[model samples]
Target: MMDIDVPGHIEKVAELEGHDDRAWCVAWNPTKPVLASCSADKTVRLYHFSKTDADTENPSVTFVHNTTISTGHTKTVRSIAWAPSGTTFATGSFDSNIGIWEQESSDEDDEMHGEGVKTGEWECMSLLEGHETECKCVAYSTSGTLLASCSRDKTVWVWEVHPDADFECMGVMMEHSQDVKCVAWHPTEEILASASYDDTIKLYIDDPSEDWFCFTTLTGHTSTVWSLAFSPNGRYLASSSDDCTIRIWERIEQHKWECVKVIEGQHERSIYSLSWGVGKRRGDDGKGEFGGWLASTGGDGKINIYEIYEPPSSSDPKGREPPTHTLIATLPSAHGVHDINHVSWCPRQGYEDLFATAGDDGIVRVWRINLNGQ
Candidate 1:
C-alpha cells in the first residue's frame, strides 16, 4: 500500500524576520494562505503568500509581510490559534492572559499610505485572565465553540465562546502533575488532548453532565511532552517529547488509546513540535500516490519527514497491526544552530504540503514538501 521507492524534498519558501526576540509559535489561518507567529518580543506578525508566487521546482518561495500587532501582554507571547471561521484568533502569553483578537472589516486610510506595506488592524476584543502562572498554549475546537488553554499552573482551562465574542470559563482540569505544555482539540470532535512536563498526555471529553472530564492518560515518554497533533481523520495522535522521540497513539476503542509506534534516536536533540499533512508518493506506474506526511522539528535545528502507509485491510488475517513509518527526507540545521520551537502545518483547504516553523533565532520560515513526478 506504500511506494517505498518514492522520495520527498523540503523547499524553503519564505523567511520572516521582524521579531526582536525568540519566536515561539507559528500557526496558519484555517481558511487563508496567511500565517500568524508569536514571539517573546511581545508581538505577533502576520504574513501572506500569493499562490502564483509559489515555485515548486525552486528551493524556496517568497512571502510578504502583512501586518504586525504589538499586543499589550507584558510578557512573552507563547502561542496562537486561529478559529475555523478565520475571522478571529487567540494568543496565550507568559503574562498569564489569553487575548482574543478579531480582524476588522476594513483598514484605516492612514495604514494605506505606505507603498509596499500591507497592513490591517486587529483589535484585542477581550483578555481572559485566570491562569495563576504563564499560559503556554491555546487552541480552539473545530466548531469554534470551545477554547482550551494550558498553563504552568498545571491546569487546563476550557472556555465557552459566546456569539458576541465573550468568553466564559467552562472548566478547569487539574489532572497533570507538572506544567502543561500544549493543548490540542480533535480535528472534528470536542475531544481535547493536553501534553505536560510530567511526561504524559491526557484526553478529556465533555460528559452529559455539561462538564469536561479527563477520561484517559497516555504515559510512555521518559521526558517532558512538548507538543501533540491529531491525525486528519482523528483516529491517531502524534506527540513529540524531550526524550527525542515521536510517539504515535492510535484510538483502539472508545476512550482507550495505545502507543503503537515510536520513532527514536533520529532526532539529535529534544523534539519540540510535530504536524501531520498529506503528500504525494511516486510509483513505478508514473502516477503518484497520496499518503500521510508527518513532520517533526527539534532543538537539533532539523526538520524530519516521515510517511505513514495506508491502514491494514479489514480482511487481513493478522488483524490490525501497528502502522509502519518510513523516513523520507531530512532538513538538517533548519534554523542554523538555533532551536526550532514549533512547526505547524497550514490548515487552509488546498495547502496541505505547506507549513511554518518558529525558531529561537527570531525567524519564522515557511516550507513546502514536493514529491518528484507529482
Candidate 2:
C-alpha cells in the first residue's frame, strides 16, 4: 500500500433550487461561471455567479438563478451539455428529441441594472429528431463541431454541426445491445465514448469512408455502465456503473485502450456519475497540493473524492511505485438520500476545484473541495 498523506475535505457552497421535479443533469459553462441544469419538469435552469458570487477568498459562494427556459420536449429532459464556445447548449429528452438551445436577447430591461435576463431568454435553435426511444445523454466534441447522442433505442447518433448552426446526421452506430446510458467526448480529441446497459462502453472514431466507426468496445463491468468522463489530458477515461464500481481506462497506443484499474466495493449502490479534475498534492514537506482528482456520485447518495497518485520509478531506491487511487474524502447523503443523477466539475481554469451535483431531490448543489484539508 502507498502512504498517501494529503488531507482532503468537501464543503457545500450552495444549494440551488427551482425545478419542481427531479433534476437529471448539471453542466458547467466552459467559458463562464454559469451552470446549467436540466430536469424532469421539462425545463432547463441556468445558475449564474456575479462578481460577488465568485469570491474565492470567502471559501463558499452562492449562485443565483439566472433563468428558467421551458423546452418543447414533452417528456423529461434527461441531460444537458454546453458547447465549448459557451454560447449554445444541447438537451437530450425522454421525448426522443435533442434540442439545441442558444442564448437570445430578452425583452426584459433588467440587464442594465445587473439583474439577469428574463426566464425565457433561451430559444431552441433546432431539434434533431431521430431516436426511436428516450434520448438519455448528449455531448459535444471539444471543438464543438460534432455532437453525439445516445438513446434507450440502443443506438448512438453522431451529428455534424454546420457553419449555419444546422446539424446534419453524420452516422448512426447501432452497436450496443442494450439501452445507451451516457455519452462523452475526449477532452482534446474527436473520439466519442458511449456507455450502455449492456455492460459495455464503445469508443467511436471518425472515418472518411465509413462516416464514424466503433474503434473499440471496453468491457468488464458486470452491470449497466452508467456514466463516463475523460481526464483533462484526454489520455485516461473513467467509467461508473450499476455494479457499484469505477473503472479507469488509459490509452496505450494511438488507437488502443485498456482498462487498467477497477475500483469496487466503494459505494453501497450504483455509481451514477463521475467527474475528473486536478487535485492538489502536498509537497515533500507538506507545503503544497496539485495533482489528479476524481469525484463520483451515486445511488447511495454519497459523493466520494479520490486522489490519482502516479508514483515515481519503482526501480530507483528512492522513487515511489505505480499509480494508485486513494480515497481522500467521502460525503454521505450529499443529496439527503436522493440519488444523484449527475456530477460535473467546473471547467474553468481558476475554478477547477468546484463541482455541481443534481439529484432526484430536485436540487443542484455546488461544492468546493479543499484538498489541503485546511
Predicted model with the maximum TM-score: 1
lDDT of 2 by residue, 83-128 (tens): 8988889999999999998866655644545333334467888999
lDDT of each: 0.86, 0.86
How do the residues 104-158 of candidate 1 rate in per-residue lDDT, one tens digit apiece? 6565545564232334589999999999999999999989999999999999999
Q: List runs of model 2 lying over 4 Å from the truth.
A: 1-6, 51-56, 106-120, 284-291, 311-322
Give lDDT: candidate 1, residue 293. Answer: 78
What is the Cα-based TM-score of model 2?
Answer: 0.90
- Largest lDDT belongs to which candidate? 1
